[model samples]
Target: MYDEILLPVAPVGEANDAITHAVGLAERYDATVHVVSAADTAVDTLAGPRTGAFSERLVDAAEERVEAVTDELEAAGVETVGSVARGDPLEVIENAIEDGADIVVMPSHTRRGIRRLLLGSVTEKVIRVASVPVVTVPMAESEAEGERSDAAVDDVGGASGSR
Candidate 1:
């Protein structure tokens, strides 16, 4: 049902669950997956130049994040690639879709109230704008934390290999 899939990476701290979940979906669909960093879009651009150090730093960090994700996915034999850009989370994600994503697999932290109002809705925006489906894994910090055990994550017919 989907072709190219966009799996936006958050951080080792916040996104561990998202990555694991996205990987499962990618494997099931035999899709060419992209593990991109959402950091560039989360930065404070008004505080820095278009190509400023802050932006550079953000992209650099994102590069590292994507690299780690690529390592994980590639080891699993999932076809994976990555990229970065700056804008509203939804807009940047839409750009990824434009580049060739057919679906976006994301995890929601499920924050609500003033936080959602002030920061606006990213996944909501993606759903509204994307021509493709966006499958969101429920935010499960607890399960994610414990997923290192084999009982949790199913192998993507994956093998352990180096990045």
Candidate 2:
């Protein structure tokens, strides 16, 4: 029943689950998948002219992310379009929705309790505000474990348990 499927990804490379899910849904519905990545450029004025350079990097990373996902979708035989936008992620996603997305498919990170509270959640916010259906693919267990391990290492000043 979907004519256009929207997939919003971060610049990270951990969205395979969401991509797979979107591919299946798009194939089933014969819908075009529109992949979008948001470059979060919200910065304080104290950053000054450096903000332009930093924003460019973010936008470039976001463009790469969109291209990667679009390639994956097209390789899977799904028609796809992609773009990178600069702004708050939620706002970017909402604008995509308004642009003609029938539904949204995205990955939800595995963060809990204090971490979840502190880091906040774009997926949660999207679910709350989206006018169309939002399908969330839970992050793979291995990915979640990797994130936890990375966090632990960072917490200990990059010292690993093995060393």
Candidate 3:
């Protein structure tokens, strides 16, 4: 029941899962995938003139991210389009929805406790704001477990046991 699938890609590896999920949905519904990346360019005023250069770089990087994801999805036989926008991430994604996104399929990165509290989450914000359905594929269980295991090991104050 989806006509347009909006896949908001992160600039990091977390996007792979989201891409896989969105591509699968797109294949099933024969829908077009609109892959978008946000260039977070909101910086302090003291940064000044450097902000222009920084924004340009971020936009360029975002474009590359979208292009790469679009190419991969298209190669898999899905119709895909890409766009890069600069501003508050939530607003940029909301604008994509306004542009005609019937649904949004995005990955929810694992941010825990204080970190989650302080940084909030893009997926959460989008879900709260977007009018359309938002399908959030959280970090794969295995991946999340692995990350927790690694963190647990690191948290050990002093591991006297020899490997």
Candidate 4:
């Protein structure tokens, strides 16, 4: 049912759950996984403030992220390849659609109430714009329950990359 899986690696938090899910799907369907991450925000600085040149920081960060994600997928016994590009999620995903990708498996991230209201969900943008079908993995029930605690910030919600 799926061809190429586009797994987006969120900056900092990473997409551990998405990779696991993608690996399982790829194994079942014998599909290729294309781990993609759109460079919407600058991937620089560990926290707090931006440091050094934008190009240097973004490229370094994106490269590291792409390598980590690809390595994780491969380590999980799934064949994978990926690219890091800068642009809007929907635009970049649509632009990166490879020849044999019939479906786009994305881990749509949640922006929460006001942020979502103001900026809109990246998944929403991709879904509205992507030419192929998209698969979304919402936050796990267990993860959601922990949101009320101090660990709330640790749980990154949803995964919506692309295929």
Candidate 5:
């Protein structure tokens, strides 16, 4: 019944499962996957010029994330459209849904306790507010750990491998 499947991805590598799940569902329904990445510019905007630079970087990263995800989906022979929107993550997603998404498929982090509180769960928020069906793909613990390790290596001047 799905015609457009919305898949929101963060700049993190934890979205592999969600991407794969979306591909499968999109293939089954012959739906076009609209991949979106949010460049969160809502925080620390009082720095003026520096804030503008930072927001630009965020948008660039979000664009790269969308491109990578769309490339993967297209490689799998699934129809895809992608965009990088600058806004709150939830707002970007909500706007995509309003643009005519039939369903949403997204990654759910396993953050708990204080961590979850400090970094609010967008997936949980989407589930609560989205009018369309929300499908959450949980990231495996090992996969999450691997992503963290890769980030650490990248921070130390190591190159990250492709997905």
Candidate 6:
């Protein structure tokens, strides 16, 4: 039922699950995927040139994130295109949805207690505000273990090819 699927990539390990899920769903529906990497850049412009430099860094990272997902989808034979945007996370995603997303596929992390309350989820915010259907994927146990493994490897100055 999806003609245009929008998948937003987060700068975290959990995003792998969302990318995988989105690619699978897109393949099933033969839909073109619109991937977006959003960096929250609502900082005060009073920071002068430093603000511009910071925004550039965010955009660069976002582009890298988007490229990685697009490359994975392309390798899987799925049609995809992507863009990087700067704004509030929810607003950036909502703008993509309004552009032409039939549905949104995203991942949510398991946060609890004080952390969950303090940093409310972007996926939750998007779900609340998005006009289209939202598919929320949770990171699987195996994936979580893999992420831990990857982290351990990184801590010891090792490279992870899993991604």
The digit string of per-residue lDDT tens for model 1 on 1-163 reads 6668888754233345567766777788888888765544333535656636655555566677678878888888888887655544555677788888888887654545864465344566667778888887666756444422332111110111100
TM-score of each: 0.71, 0.85, 0.81, 0.71, 0.84, 0.81
* Cα lDDT for residue 2, candidate 2: 98
* Weakest lDDT window of 10 consecutive positions for candidate 6: 153-162
lDDT of each: 0.59, 0.74, 0.70, 0.59, 0.74, 0.69
The residue pairs found clashing in candidate 2 are: none
- Please name the candidate that would achieve the greatest TM-score relative to the true structure: 2
Q: What's the number of clashes in each of the models?
A: 0, 0, 0, 10, 0, 0
Clashing pairs in 1: none
- Tens digits of per-residue lDDT for model 3 on 100-120? 999999877576787567645
Model 1 TM-score relative to the real fold: 0.71
Candidate 4 matches the true fold with a TM-score of 0.71
lDDT of 3 at 9: 70
- Kindly indicate the candidate among 4 and 5 with the higher lDDT: 5
Report the candidate with higher TM-score, 2 versus 3: 2
**Candidate 2 ranges beyond 4 A from true positions:** 44-46, 145-163
Model 5 agreement with the true structure over 104-136: per-residue lDDT tens digits:
998776767865675456778888999999998
lDDT of 6 at 27: 87
lDDT of 1: 0.59
